[model samples]
Each structure stands twice: as structure tokens, then as C-alpha cells.
Target: MSFSASSPVSFVRAAVDGEIARFLDRRRAQLLEVGSELVPVADALEAMLAGGKRLRPAFCYWGWRGAGGADVAGIHAAAASLEFLQACALIHDDVIDNSDTRRGLPATHKRLESLHAASGWTGSAEAFGRGAAILIGDLCLAWSEDLYQASGLGPEALQTGRVPFDAMRTEVMAGQYLDMLEQVREDGGVEATLRVMHYKAAKYTVQRPLHLGAALAGRYDDLAPVYTDYGLPLGVAFQLRDDILGVFGDPEQTGKPAGDDLREGKRTLIVAETLERTGSADRAEFLRHLGDPLLSAETVEWMRGAAEDCGALAACERRIDDYVAQATAALETGRIDATARSALADLVVAATARKH
Candidate 1:
């Protein structure tokens, strides 16, 4: 049998994709009544949702299965609602970062900005794009709840998932504020940076999704602890890999410009570690160019070299391996459902070990 045949996540991804498409198709016409101009709003959302690996939904699906929930269509739709939450984050994040592209195309804000310019709108195109994108993000956040409420699960099941669903959204928004704060502070060191990762990626990306799924299964207490232990470390490793990619990944594969993170001056663990490992001169130069919007390729290359030469890059890689090992070990606990355990093992690898 194919690996997917036995994998809850693999099956749910396909199902969830169909559900989202159907949901958007119905909403598109309704939204057009507000204004024909608003059609592009939904268009940007559709495009953003199209290309992700659906990792959040995967974790949620397996979390439910691991907690003994059966594979039902209602649960699949509930699991798929996580993507709408993710879309909210990405749209707002792109606006905050002033990113030009996402998933190899113009970001939502950029697309809206282009729309303004092409139509001879009277205001600043940049301001219009930013405003429109924020509204889009808010709409996605609202629709996430709509999807969850309309998921057709039992009342109790929906109630169970609601707690984590609420917590996840609140925590991520707080984490996003922290991330913006870090960029402004002169020093956010490893400890502070990791704090952002924990709230932003660890909790928002994995732990809550898994908990939300387990809650939907009706006996979250059975697997909640195990899922937390597994999810947090794995989530951090996933973001760490993303940090590596943000600086060094192939632009085509990552769907963003090379060194975008460095250009934006994100206070990632990788950058923090590099400062600790490198000498004062290299550190000074790195900081000077860290947030430069017009940072040059030669300067980025030099900074990358400095980080590598100081052994920071190798250390970060080692940290990723260590976390992956911890996350994998959590699945071995005897309390876990056997079939779901195997699927989650595959998910651990998929979540952390990716080119994107």
C-alpha cells in the first residue's frame, strides 16, 4: 500500500482541499454583491490557500486519530479550518514584513497595491494595499470560526475544540506583536528569540492544532500531554529550518526572495546565535546591515560566510537534529494509539525536514 493509504494526514489533505474549494466557491458569488471590486479580495485568499503543504491540518487530523477519533467527513472539515487560521497569519505577516511575494507570486498586499496603481486610484497605492491586506486577514480570521462552527460535528466535539481554537488565535496574535517588538529592540538574544518561536511557531503551528484535534476526539486528556511534548519541539525545529531557508534557501523553492529574513532584520535564533559566536567586528558589521531594506547581495554573502565560519550554522543544525529526536521519542509512549503513532512519525519528518 502507498504510505498515504495508511496516513491520516495524507488522506485529510486531499479531503480538506476539496472542502476549502467548495467553501470558497460558494462565498465568492456572495462576496461579489458587496462590490465587484471586492472579488479580488477573495481571489487573493484563494491563491494564498492553494500552495501550502497543509501541515497544520495534517497535525490536527492525526491528533484526532491518535486520540481514537474515527475518520469522518465532519472531522475532516473541522481539521481543514486550520488553514483559514494559517491564511490569516500569512496575510498579516506579509503586510508586516512588506513582502513582495509569497508562494512564487505577488503577495496579497502587493497584488492589491498593483490593483490600485492600475486603476488610477487617488490614494497612495502602498497604503491602499496595506489596508486591504489587513482587512483580508481579518476576514480570514472570521471565516475560520465560520468553518469550525459549520463543521457538522457533535456539539460536544465542537465545544471541546473551541478552547484551543480560541487560545491558538490569541497566542499567535500576541506572538506576532512580540516578533514586531523584537525587530525594534537592540538586543533580543537567544532566550528572547526562542520565546517568540515558542509562542509563534511551537504553540500556534503545532501544539494547539494537535490539541484542538485531540479535543475534537472527545478524550483529549488521553493524548494532550503527549501531543504537547511532541508538538512543541518539532514545531521549533520546523521554524528553525524555515529560518535557515529564509536566508539560504533557493528562491524558487522557498517562494520568497533570498535573504529576505536578514533584510527584514528578523530576530531569529539563527541570527542571535551568530552574534554570540562571531567576533565583535563581524557582529558590528552584521548588525549594521541587518535591517537594511536595500542590503546588497555581496553583503549578505559576507554575513552568511561569517556566520558559517564562526560555527553558528553548524550549531543550529545540531539543535534541529536534537529537537527532532525529542519530538520523535514522544510518539513511543505506550499510551498513544498504535495506528496513529506510525502516521505521526511520518508527519514529524515531513514537518521538520523540508526544502520549503
Candidate 2:
């Protein structure tokens, strides 16, 4: 379960994976105690957890390190808890977006649906799959809290970290709701899109993780601002890169079809900017294919071209570069240690410039 990276927090990343593996093993055994029918629930969760760069845990580790916290099993378990939370978000998000695949495999809901069909179940397979996936997400959410409680940290330390832990959960849900609203309202302005991105991903993915780490170290009051200064812009840049990859990234690398975001009717910054830049007639043409589920490769290419001609893609790239710069500047605040500073610098590239 370990992931090897050149970053300074690679050791922490491996430790977090070890923690997650051991925790899941316990969970799997408990599930089996109920019945063999529950094995697929464990399997789906493990499969979904198999991918990802483990970015969040790394940030949390560095946050702790920056705040002068020692490396320990408790922190690793605490960081591992974030992975369960992430799993909850991803599973439910796939259901909402009707994503067929994740990480080159059938999404949780689709997997359950296929199982229901193969078993010749009597009920609606689609509904069964969706319902099962939703329950799995709920289970993951509950398990996140369970893992946190089992982290073995003292009451004081756990209490400190709980602030950001709780805030991250609440903010992510709020952000997700805003994202849902954006999709429903077809709101894609810079302001609306950024507002959604900020709460949904920016704070949840980066800021709060860092805050969690610092909080556990009992240095939240001292380091909270620095974490935010670095985390917020970096998170936005990371998601902006994700938006670009959603549109133009290689399928082999991203594990998603090219232009999948467009097909899903995502009101991403790219789409919003493109709409703002195009003439009314061009906007109409672009909107026609923006969310076409059966969208053709030819049309995707045209939209790509249109986006390029309108400079929306280039504009996003520029913003990514600028935001990365802002995040980098925040690191020079003379608050973080040398090791944490250097590792966080490496993360800027990992977060904002990743392929998947």
C-alpha cells in the first residue's frame, strides 16, 4: 500500500498507507463477521482507495513537521483518517456526476450495478447500485471519525486537531452543495466558480489539512495564517490544473475520458472563462456540446480548438502559474522550518502540475 515519491514527506506518505492498510484490515474482518455479502463493500472501498497520490496526508504531515511535531504512529493514523474522508467524497461525487469509471475501473455505483445484474437480482440494478454506493460513502464518512478516534493521540492533541478536522468536513460538504447548485443554475461566472472552488476543494484539500497538522502540534494559533496563505492558493491552482486535465488530459494518464468534464456539464473555471470570452453565437455553439454525454471526439476537438482560439485554456495556465507563485511567496514567511519549507515547495509542483 506504500507509495514512493521523491518528496520529503514520502516517509510520512508510506507510514500513512501502512496505517490505512492496518485499519482497513480491521474493518474488513468486522464486515465479514456480519456476512460474506459485505465483502464487496470492503472490496469496493479498497479498490477506490488504490489510486491517488496521497497528497492530503503529505500536506498534513508537513504541517505537523513545520510546527515542530515529532513523527509518530498517532499522527500517521490521524493523517490516514483523511483518506477515508476523501474516499467518501469521491464515491458520492461519482454517483452525483454519473461517472462510469474512476481510476480506469468501474465506479463504485457502476460496479455494484454490474454485480446486481450478474446476480440476476429482482430489484432495479441501477437503483441498487446507486443506493449501495451511497451507503458505502456514508460508511466511509463514519469510519473517518472512527479512525481519528483510534489515532492513539492524547486527548489534548486530538482535541486540538479536531477543530480543523471538523471544519474540513463541514466546509467540504458546503462546497459540494455549492458545486451542485452551480450545476443546477448553470452559473459559471468567475466569482461564482471561484466561490465554489474555494470551499469545495481549496480549503478542504489543502488549508484544513495543514491546519489539522499544526493543530495537532498545538501550534494552530501561531501557524494557521501561514498554512492558509500557502494552502489556499495552492489548492486553487491544483484544482485549476484538474479542470484543465478534465478537458485535455491524456486518458491513459488521467484514467478518465478526454473532455469528460465537458460531458458531465461541469461548470469549471475553464468552461466559465470560455463562455465569457466567446461571442453570443460562439457561446451558443459551445454550450451545445458543453454537456453532451454522447459527445463525439470530433466535437471535443472542436471545443478544444474553440477554447484555444478564445484563450481560455491559456488563461487557466497563466492563472495556475500565478497562483503557484503566490503560494510560493507565502512559504517565505520565515515561519516554517527548512525541511517543511523544502517539502512544501516540492508539493507545489505535485499539486498544481500533476497529470491526474
Specify the highest-lDDT model's number.
2
lDDT of 1 by residue, 1-356 (tens): 22442254566779999889988887788799888988889898899889788888988888888888898888878988889999999999999998888888999999999999999989799999999999999988888999899989999999989889899999999999999998898677888989999999999888999999899988688788999999999999989999998888888889887888889888888899999989999899899999888888898898788878998888889989999999999989987678778888887778777788
lDDT of 2 by residue, 1-356 (tens): 22223465566778888988898999999999999999889999998877667888889988998898888889889989999999999999999999999988999999999999999999899999999999999999999999999999889999988899999999999999999999989855978999999999899989999999999999999999999999999999989999999999999999999999999989999999999998899899999888889999999998888888999999999999999999999999788877788888888888887788
TM-score of 1: 0.97
Q: Model 2: which ten-residue window has the lowest total lDDT?
A: 1-10
Candidate 1's C-alpha runs over 4 A off are 1-9
Clashing pairs in 2: none
